[model samples]
Target: MGTLDEIKAALINLDIPQVQCKIHQGLAEGLSPSAILEKSLIAGMNTIGSRFKEGDFFMPEVLVAAKAMHTGLDILKPLLTAVENRVKGTVAIGTIKGDLHDIGKNLVIMMLEGAGFEVVDLGVDVPPDKFITAIETHHPRVVGLSVLLTSVMPQLQTTIQQLEPYRRELYIVIGGAPITQQYADKIGADGYAPDAASAVDKVRELIARN
Candidate 1:
């Protein structure tokens, strides 16, 4: 198999060490960092995500696969030029204000990064002003909000309200255990993802719409 294919398989198997070794080997063989990232790591993550959505894989599987992908990325990141890394659109993501939960948010960030987007993770319990600050500073095309608490739904609403005045026509996507499409619509969010895998697809769709 080709080096890229081997890397993809290693990622799917969650073989972190193997993935790292193959990435280095590929580099030694004169493979471009961009080629390794785009053709191998991205492809593997996409497959794992699809399988998770189909019930063919679960969280543990996805987590391990994501870890392996990250391991490979660590090797390639420094080799990539600024221009290449900036090819994908930027994204700012966080758990809504008053919500301490972050597992979901972190997963979404990982998937976003794996898909090539530059992710600015604001961590958990992010206030409306923080979101606004990130948007102003980063000028991301997409903003992802995650809230796992029912009480924090209002916080999400408040965040959206705050963003409206400073908005540059950016796409706002919401997700969490309690978040639904109806809730997203009520809060004026542009989209809602039920899970991390779907978040990647939703963000891609949002990007396409613009």
Candidate 2:
């Protein structure tokens, strides 16, 4: 297999050391940082997300793979310095009020950053006004809402509804263990991601549509 393929495999296996090493190899071989990101790190994370959706991979494996992706990203990031800060697009993300879970939020942020989007993190327990403030401040192309609790689901809807004034101005994407496409549709969100890898995909799609 090729060095790029090796990079992808090391990431899927969650081999942090190998991932970093392969990234170095890719750079030495003259592979562009964007090529390394799309072909290796994002590609591997996409497979992990598919497995998680199919119930073949669990949270521990997903988190480990995320770590491996970060290892590779740490190497590629500096090389990508010129375009690293949102040449792709900007996204404002946060966990809704009363929901403190961030593992899912953090994973998505990692993937977004790796994909070359500048993320304005709103942090956890964020209110609707904070969302609006971020929208006004960053003028992000997408706004992401993460909800980990079934009870806090209403807050997600409230946040979305409260942002109706900005609906025409930006796209909204929602994700978390408790979040689903159905819930997203019901709450009038623009997109839904089932896993961290797909979160990047979803944002890409949103950017295209926007």
Query: Model 2: residues >4 Å from true position, as ranges?
Result: 47-62, 81-86
Model 2 residue pairs with clashes: none
lDDT of residue 61 for candidate 1? 93
For model 1, where is the 10-residue window of minimal lDDT?
78-87
Cand. 1 Cα-lDDT: 0.84
Give the RMSD in angstroms, all C-alphas superposed, for model 1: 4.0
Off by over 4 Å in 1: 1-14, 22-66, 76-85
Each candidate structure's TM-score, on Cα atoms with residue i matched to residue i, is: 0.70, 0.84
The lowest-lDDT stretch of 10 consecutive residues in candidate 2 is 78-87
